[model samples]
Target: MLLLLDTANLEDIKKGIDLYPIEGVTTNPSIIARENTNFLSRICDIKDTIGSGRMLHVQTVGLKADDIVREGVYLNQLMGDNFYVKIPVIPEGIKAMKVLKSMGVATTATAIFTPQQVVMAARAGASYAAPYINRIDNIIGDGVKVVEDISRIISTHNLDIKVLGASFKNTEQIHKACLAGAHTITAPLDLVETLVNHPLTGASVEKFSIEWESVYGKKLTYDF
Candidate 1:
């Protein structure tokens, strides 16, 4: 499964990249607004930091179909060809998605809550459908089941779309999403760091290092 960082903070993003094999960064208006800086310059700086080859998913705030499409196109022009324009899964958003898909732009359907929405977004030609896992669990208590159902639907219908699970509160939710067949997940940096660490793993590594140093006089394995 692919992993992406759901943040726009450059410092966290740089650290995330240095620490993990992050495929890209995903951002909504709230994330962008937190910087409280020039929008274009901030996005451009993000593009520069992540480099041109990585995927950058940016959401559109437009509420109308036409306006959403326009904003998506504009964002594409601003970011570059590799950018994925994220739209909501509302009626207007689906319409905008169709229009954007016809124009050959990579699109992601966001704010999804069910398998039906995932199927709708895929039918509307979204390259990825993002389901809010923690939000769904907060309201209904079966977020992982929803992701699994979406995954089953994708496989049963042979849809050319992937589930992008988001809004995670912890690494266990991430693990459930993956086991439920989410093709990708976008999470905060803290959770991403958690994914790489465990008490046993750290203790084992420390023990191994101590034993090695006892014999090698503080030399790293590579130095030998």
Candidate 2:
């Protein structure tokens, strides 16, 4: 599965890139606004840090189809071919996706809460469909199950789109989403770190270190 960092902070992006095999970065308007910097400059900085080869998904702030298309074109021109414009799974967004698709601009359908929305977005030519996992669960819906259903629907319909499971609150939610067949997932750096660490793993490493130090009176293997 492809792992993506869902943030707009350059420091976090750099740290995540240095530590993990992050495929790309995904940013919404809220994330971008949190940085409180020039939008174009910040996006450029992020692209420089991650390089042009990696994918960058940026959401559009347009509410109309024409405006969304214009924004998508502008972002495509700014970020190049590796960029995926993120649009909401609404009527205008679907219309924008169709126009973007005709122009060969990649798109990710965001703000999704249902499998039917995935279908509509995919049919409209979205390269990816993002579902809010924790948000769905917050409303008493089975988020993981929704992802699973989306996967099945994709396979059954042979849709050429991926499920980008998003809005996770914890590692368990991420794990479940992966198991539920999420082709990709975007999460915060802390949650990504949790996936790489565990108390048992740390304890085991410490035990090994103690045994080695006791035997050699040094922590470095090269010292011997």
Candidate 3:
């Protein structure tokens, strides 16, 4: 499973890129516009930081297929190839996804609330389908079930599209997504760290600290 970082603040993004050991990033308009005004510059910086290693998923905001395709091409030009274009799950979005995919741009059909929507995106030749787990839970509990069901549908149909579990609010959702066999899951850095570490790790650290102090003075470490 690929771990996708959720924030786009430059320094925070760089930290996530360097320290989190993740697969890549996912940025929406809300995330990017939160701090910056230079969309092209910021996107290029992120792509450069990621270099040729990871996938950067970016959401495009537009009402038409041509508009979204333009955005995708601009992003492809600004960033390099390892970019995943995120399109909404509307009629125009499906069209845009097909065009973008045919043009060799990886397309992620976002805002997927229903398994039927997932089917449509797959039919449209999308590379990935994002189901907002937190939003699904906000409407009806058991958001993980959605991922599980979608995973089953995609697998049963043997479709080429992958399920990208997003909008995760906690490690539980991340855990459930992993258990449900999602192809990729994106989360904030805090949640990613929380999942990478467990309570057992904390308990072990605390226990080791106590034992170390008993045998010798407390040890300190600071490394870059």
Candidate 4:
């Protein structure tokens, strides 16, 4: 599954990229608002840092269909082809998705809370549909099931859209999302870091190091 950091903090972004096989970065209005900087310049900085090959998802703040379309177009123009314009699954967003998809621009339908939303967004031509996993679980306790159902529906209908699960609270949620068939996930740095921070894993590594040192006279592998 593809993993993307759902943050706008440059340090977290850099560390995540350097420490993991990060596929890309994703940001919404809330994430961008936290930076409190020039919006365009900040996004441009992210573009340069992540470089051209990775996907950078930027959300549209507009609430109207026309305005959303214009914003999506502008983002594509500003960030290039690798940028996936993120739009909500509201009615206006569906309209904008159709227009943007017609123009061959990548679109990610966000703020999804139900299977119906996923179906509609996929039908509207979203390249990826992002379901808020933790948010839905908080509301109805079936977020992972929703993702699984969406995956089944997409596969049954042969849709090309991918499920990008978001809003995770912990590594367990991410694990469940992937097991439920999400092709990708976007999460904050803390939750992502949990993917590699198991206590048993650390203990096992330390034990292996001690055993190796005992047998090899504490010498490094390069020691002659």
Candidate 5:
């Protein structure tokens, strides 16, 4: 599964990229606004930090098909071919996806809450479909099951799109999403850090360190 950081903080992005095998970074308008910087400059900085080879998913703020297409084109021109324009799975977004597809621009359907939305977006030529995991669960729906159903439907119908699960509250949700067949997941930095952190692992390392210190009189490996 592809792991992505869902944040616009430069420090977090740098730290995440340095600490993990991050495939890319995903950002929405809210995330961009939180940084309180010029949109173009901030996005440019993020693209530079991640480099051109990694995927960068940016969302469009337009609500109409023509506006969405225009925004998608503008972002594509700004970010290059590795960019995936994130559009909502509404009617206008589906229409915009079709237009963007014809223009050879990649699209990711966002704000998805149902399997049918993914199917429609895929049919509209979106390369990826993002489902809000915790949001679904907040509404009393099974988020992981939705992802599993979406994956099953895609495989059964042979769709060419991937399920990119988003809006996670904890590492367990991410874990369940991946096991449910989500091809990718984007999460905040804290949740990402917790993924590999376990008390037992820390305890084991400490135990080993104590054993070594007891034998070596607190000497470094290089000193020995």
Candidate 6:
């Protein structure tokens, strides 16, 4: 699975990139709202920190098809081909997706919950259909299943749409999405850190450190 960091602040974004094999960066209105950085400047900062060939997803809240297309074009004009314009799966978004897809700009149709939403996004020609796994699990109790069904549907239809499974709460959620064959996952830094620092794993490492201090200055080494 391709792991993405959904962060806005420069420090957090840089830190997330450092900790994981970050394939991309996912940003939304809420994430951007947390910081007062200029939109284009922060995007530049994100790109600079993450280096080249990594995606940067930007969301647009357009009320009409024309407006959505305009904003999507505007956003694309600012970034490289790897950047994906994130549009909602709403009516106007679907309309906008058609235009952008025809223009060859990558589009990520986000805020997806149900399988029907995935179908619509796939038909709309979105490159990525992002489903909020944690948010759906809160309502339906089996959010992972939605991703599985969507994957199957995409395969059956021979659609090029990717399941960018998002809103993960823990490593378990990520595991489920992977098993379901999601194309990518946009996870928060907190969850990513949790995955890296498993409780039992951390405890064992700590215990090893204490024991090592009695013998040598260091006792850990990885050989390949």
User: How much is 165 displaced in model 3, in angstroms?
Assistant: 0.4
* Model 2 segments more than 4 A misplaced: 219-224
90-170 in candidate 3: lDDT tens per residue? 999999988988888888999988888999999888989999999999997677888888899989999899999999988
Model 3 / residue 120 / CA error / Å = 0.8
Model 3, poorest ten-residue lDDT window? 215-224
Residue 207 in model 6: lDDT? 94
lDDT of 6 at 27: 91
TM-score-wise, the better of 2 and 3 is 2
* Candidate 4: tens digits of C-alpha lDDT, residues 1-224: 99999999889989999999999999999999999988888899999889998999999999999999999998899898688999999899999999999998889999999888888888888999999999998996689999999999999999889999999998888999999999999998888999989889999999999999888877677746
Worst lDDT run of 10 residues, candidate 2, spans 215-224
- Per-residue accuracy of model 6 over 1-224 as CA lDDT, tens digit each: 78899888788778887777888889988888788878778777887777767888889867688998998898888777688989998898898998999998889999998888888887888989999999999996687999999999999988879999899888999999989989899887888777677679989989988888867766556586
Model 5 misplaced stretches (Cα beyond 4 Å):
222-224
Q: TM-score for every candidate vs. truth?
A: 0.95, 0.97, 0.91, 0.95, 0.97, 0.90
What's the lDDT for candidate 4?
Answer: 0.92
Q: What is the lDDT of residue 116 in candidate 2?
A: 98
The digit string of per-residue lDDT tens for model 1 on 1-224 reads 99999998999999999988999999998989998987778888889999987889989989999999998898898888579999999999999989999998889999999899888899889999999999999996689999999999999999999999999999899999999999999998999999988899999999998998889878555745
Clashes of each: 0, 0, 0, 0, 0, 0
- Locate the minimum summed-lDDT window of 10 residues in model 4: 215-224
Whole-model Cα lDDT per candidate? Answer: 0.92, 0.95, 0.86, 0.92, 0.95, 0.86
Residues 1-224, model 2: lDDT tens digits: 99999999999999999999999999999999999998888888888889987899999999999999999999899888589999999899999999999999999999999999999999999999999999999999999999999999999999999999999999999999999999999999989999989899999999988998888877465645
